[model samples]
Target: MSVLFDRIALIGIGLIGSSLAHDIRRLGLTKEIVVATRSADTLKRAEELGLGDRYTTSSAEAVKHADLIIVSVPVGASESVAKEIAGNLQPGAIVTDVGSTKASVIAQMQPHMPENVHFIPGHPLAGTEKSGPDAGFPGLFEGRWCIFTPVAETDETALKRLRGFWEALGSKVDEMDAEHHDKVLAIVSHLPHIIAYNIVGTADDLETVTESEVIKYSASGFRDFTRLAASDPTMWRDVCLHNRDAILEMLARFSEDLAYLQRAIRWGEGDKIFELFTRTRAIRRSIVQAGQDVDAPDFGRPHPLDKK
Candidate 1:
């Protein structure tokens, strides 16, 4: 793969930014990479990891000579980052973001973007219950979906170039309007994380069960919820705030379904309960079939070797 851009600036050196740096360098995606983050320690770590050709604590300086700038900051910080780098952006630079909430990011960053530069809001449906530079690894986005919510005045050339860049990283790119993207992600991503956090919190606050006992006998279901709950609090907090409307809408629907399930259990409606479980099990099988997850037993966890 040839260099897609002469220079690319990463505005936050967290998991997403560092992962992109790994792929960009490995794939020869840019001639040079400029990494900038608000934290001096993160910038120092990024430098030590050799994540970029240049590292700085100033975002404005990072984009001054860059052809492409990818913002990897939390959703709530989008506006400030945009304001800080708006004056320093070079002509015809393509600016994009890896934010989870598209509409809010568009609202926050779009107005501050220069008319000459292209502002494309994007979300890569990929990540783990990890954060920071050390948690990032190569091929993190391979085979994952990268959705773009391009603004009304988005340049065709710029959009195509950005699509190509993600494709070169082995991602499947899709486009949707910001509203639709937010609504879709509300249920698919946001609500699940919210549910996980809530369930974990309930367990933590349990009066009948001891904390050590909860850990000692954690079933797969509870363990999975804890994994999601272990994610970065700042990022999830920003996501919930930025996509409040959509998240609330999804939450209401989920509450209705949960109430129905509770009613079924209370009334001993076995058929209804079985029907719902069967439907959800089918959905899990479909997810595995769709290449989103493995079909192996125990969600693909490696088995321990036995010594006879």
Candidate 2:
């Protein structure tokens, strides 16, 4: 298939950025791939990985003449990237992002977009616990969800081109409003990761438990939580800070439910416990039934670490 883009510039070549680079190469979706990162060392590594046709630490230089520009930086750095590339973007170029948070990214990037360009904010609900260029792999977004929060007057042709880009990389695309996308992700992605980090931190703080003992017994159930806990600290920290309001709202609900469960346990109300557990189990079933592939742990095939 002919590529939809002549050049695709990827800023911040971490796991998500590098993964997109790999898929673009595999699918032949772009005539040339330009990689840019804040650090010169990371840019060198991306070049070493052969992930891009050209590499630079200057985002402005990288995006120049590129038909598609994807910013894969942390949500907090969105504005800086937007400012850096705003003047360099070619007319009619499609500017999108793979940030975890939507509303904030839109707010940051929209102001910097040129009138001739399309600034469509997007989020791909796919990533591994690992990060960095070395940790990325091809087909990471296969069967995954990529949500686009289009502006009220977004260009249809640009939106269609971006949709085709993601679809070619094996993602299922869906469109929603920025506020709605932020709210939905807060519950489904942000809160779960925060809860996992909290639980792991709590376990690590236990006075009676040795770190080695925690490691030894982690295989039972805690290991699953640890995977999310082990995610890139800088990335997750940015997410927590950027999506504060929605995350706190979801956290409040989570705490309320947790308190209810605790009350049931304390009062020996087995019926309440059973009902809540049953409901959650049914939710898992519904997810699987909706083609989530739950049999394969962590989204698709089980992580290699779990095989041992």
Candidate 3:
């Protein structure tokens, strides 16, 4: 494919940023990639990895002369990055982000964005539990969703160009208003990570029950939650804070459902328990049908015994 932009500035060289760099280079998405990060070590590491054509610790310097800018910082740092890069942004540059919390990102970064640039808030529903520049790989966005919550004053041509960029990365792009996007992600993404972290924390506190036993018999069920629990704490912390209201709403709903399950089990309501399980199992099948996950057993985890 032809280059989508003359220059693409990546304002944070974390997993998402590095992955974009890999794909942008592999797919020929841009003529140049300027990587930036707040941490000098991270900037140095990005340079060593050859993730971009240029690297700097200054976000403002990274945006200079860029045609497209992608901010991949924590949601809480959105405004800080925006403030730093505001004045240096080139006219008509398409600026977007890969933050999970759309509403908070918009609230933080939108006001600081210059009127001449196109600021589109976005969330790429793609990533693994891994973090850092080394964890990134090509094809991470393949078969995944990239949702955009465009503002009212957004330019149509700019939005289309941004959509085309994601499409070239193998992402299935979708658009929704910021409020609705936050609500949807609260239930689908935030709550699951919250639950995972909580479950792991509870297990840690169960010393009377024996932590050693929990680790020894992890194959029972507890092992699955650890993967989600192992996600970067900083990112999750920012997600909880930035998307608090929607997350709280989802948590309340989950609490009610848990209570209903507790009452059913206490009263030996086997039929009710079976019904809920049956209904929820269908959702898993639907996700696989939609190509979001594999149909293979153990969620397609590689085992030593599997044939190559």
Candidate 4:
């Protein structure tokens, strides 16, 4: 619980950055927290919320004496933020990111990082559908996974120190190569968001079904998709553009499986449908058993089945 860093600078005061600020202050992780964002209104709001000891609109100024710097911007803006802070970074600073796509973030930020600094690309697999500075709260990362895609030339001591910081925040930390991390996240995170957006869009485009009817009759399955679809659009757009290759690969595989299910339904193959459903149900059970999620229906919410 002692100070892990003398000063920690947060670039982009959105959900992740603000959440880190809350946890850092709550756990006494840093002597000072410098919060920076491009928007003046957001900077003012961060100050009002007391999320940091110092607030600035300039990223470079925020990191002038910061020992640890976390970039929480969208992946598309990673390069510009890196360029701005590259010249101002203190020697031996630990630079990390909370980007969803690791390879693209590394490609954009690594080149600009100074040789003395440790540029570790990381993704914390934790969030809600909400965003903005107000959406952040303490314990957001507790029991979640924080994966670091460290480069070959990364300093081992710096990496361990960064890991310790996340661990102190109650996160389980792991490391993987950038390419493999991208591939794994494409299916687990990217594809699911893409599917949710697509499904919601399709429902919206249904000419025969009135909007009110769709809302009134929405079942748990459709409601869950809406929750994922409600995530920050700018961040998801950047994720899609940055991780195009891996997402396309997963999309192709998803299409093939969808076609198989379509063929089975067309042929009235009840056994095939039942077999697939049974297998998928087991996967859900495994997730619950692994402590990743609760076994309660509707993600631990009240379901129609519980009404009676």
Candidate 5:
């Protein structure tokens, strides 16, 4: 694909930033990629990975001439990043972010953006339980949904350009308002991660369940939860803080449902258990049928089961 911009600045060289860099390089999405991070150590690691053409610890300096600037950091850092780079961003530059909490990021960043620049908040519903520059890999966004929660009165041309950019990286783009995006992601992404983290913590706290035994007995189900628990603590903490309301709402519902399930199990209500289990299994089947399971090993490939 042809390069979309002369220079693209990434203002956080962690998992998402480095993953964007990898895909940009792989797909030849930009003429120059400038990687920036708050930590000098991370910048150095990104340099070693050859994730970009230029590396810097200064966000302002990195965005100076860039036509596209992506702020790929924790939601809590959005304000600082916006303050640092607001003046340096090129006029008419399409600025976007890959922050998890949409409304909070927009709240933090929107005030600092100048009229000449486009500030669109985005969240890619894709990631692994990994962090840092080295954890990134190409094709991370391929077939993944990148949700752009554009504020009202957002520049349409700039939004279109950003859509093109993510498309070039093999992402399918969708748009929603910031609050709706937050609510939806709270149920789908945030709740699951919180549950995983809680479950792992619960297991760790059990006196009868030895740590060694937990480790030794972990099969596919427990192993998946472990992956979510292994996600970057700082990042997850920031997400929980920034998206507090939505997360709390989802958590409340989750607790209510869990209590019902627990009651059913304790009473040996086999029919209730069977009904809920069957419904949940049907949901998974629907996902498979819709081809929405990108994390599945057969993504973008024919499944042997399909042939059968």
Candidate 6:
């Protein structure tokens, strides 16, 4: 493929950022990939891994003269990154992010973005529980969704360019309003992770269930929750804080549904339990059929160390 940009600045050296670096290099997406992160150690590691052509601890310096800038930091830190890079953005540059919470990211970064740059809020529905540069690999976003929540004043040419970029990375692109994106993610993504964390915590707190027993028997459904709960704590904490309202709304509904299940169990309503289970099982099948997930018995996941 032809080079999409002259210079691509990656303003975070974590999983998403490194993955993009790998894909960009693999696909020859840019002439130069400048990697930036606040941590000296991470920047060094990124250099050691050869994820980019240049490495720097200064986000502003990294973004200077870049044709495209991708901010892959936590949602809570979006504002700070925006402030640091605002004045350094080149004219007509395309700036985008891979934050999970769309509305919060827009609220934090949009104000600081220069009028000359195209600031499009985005969320790539792709990742594993693992993080860091080592956890990233090529083809991570293959066949996955990358949703853009473009602002009202977004430039059409810029939006299409960004869409073409993601498409080149093998992602299916979609567009929606920021508010709707947040609410949809709250139910589909955030709630599941929250439930996983809660279930894992509950298991840990079970006084009668020994830790050894839990580990030995975790090959069941509990293991799945553990994977989700094992995701980066800082990222999840920021996600919870940034998308509070939508998450709380989803949690309220989840609690009410849980109560209904509890009542069904207490009343020995087999039909009610079976009906709900049957309907919910279809959702998983649909996901597989839609090519969003695999139908493998192991959930198509590799060991943590194997991700690299």
Global lDDT of each candidate? 0.94, 0.92, 0.94, 0.94, 0.90, 0.94
Q: List the candidate 5 regions with Cα displacement exceeding 4 Å.
A: 294-308
* Residue 227, candidate 5: alpha-carbon lDDT: 80
Which lDDT tens digits does candidate 6 get at residues 1-308? 98999999999989999999999999999999999999999999999999999999999999999999999998999999999999999999999999999999999999999888999989999999999989899999988999999999999999999999999999999999999999999999999999999998988989899988999999877997998899989999999999999999999999999999999999999999999999999998998898777898687667777777
The lDDT of model 2 is 0.92
**13-72, model 1: which lDDT tens digit per residue?**
889999999999999999999999999999999999999999889999999989999999
Instruction: Give the better candidate number (1 or 6) by TM-score.
Output: 1
| Candidate 4: tens digits of C-alpha lDDT, residues 1-308 | 89999999999988999999999999999999999999999999999999999999999999999999999999999999999999999999999999999889988999999998888889999999999999999999999999999999999999999999999999999889989999999999999999999999999999999877888888746888999999999999999999999999999999999999999999999999999999999999999999999988667787677789
Clashes of each: 0, 0, 0, 0, 0, 0
Question: Higher-lDDT candidate among 3 and 5?
Answer: 3
The regions of model 3 sitting more than 4 angstroms off are: none
Give the Å error, residue 186, model 2: 0.7
Candidates 4 and 5, the one with greater lDDT = 4
Candidate 1: how large is its RMSD? 1.1
Rate residue 59 of model 4 by lDDT. Answer: 99
lDDT of 3 by residue, 1-308 (tens): 89989999999888899999999999999999999998999888998999999988899999999999999998999999999999999999999999999989999999999899999999999999999999899998987899999999999999999999999999999999999999999999999999999999999998588989999999888999999999989999999999999999999999999999999999999999999999999999998998778899898778887766
lDDT of 1: 0.94
Which regions in candidate 1 have their CA more than 4 angstroms from the true location?
306-308
Sort by lDDT, best first: 4, 6, 3, 1, 2, 5
lDDT tens readout by residue for model 2, 29-66: 98999999989899888999999999899999999999
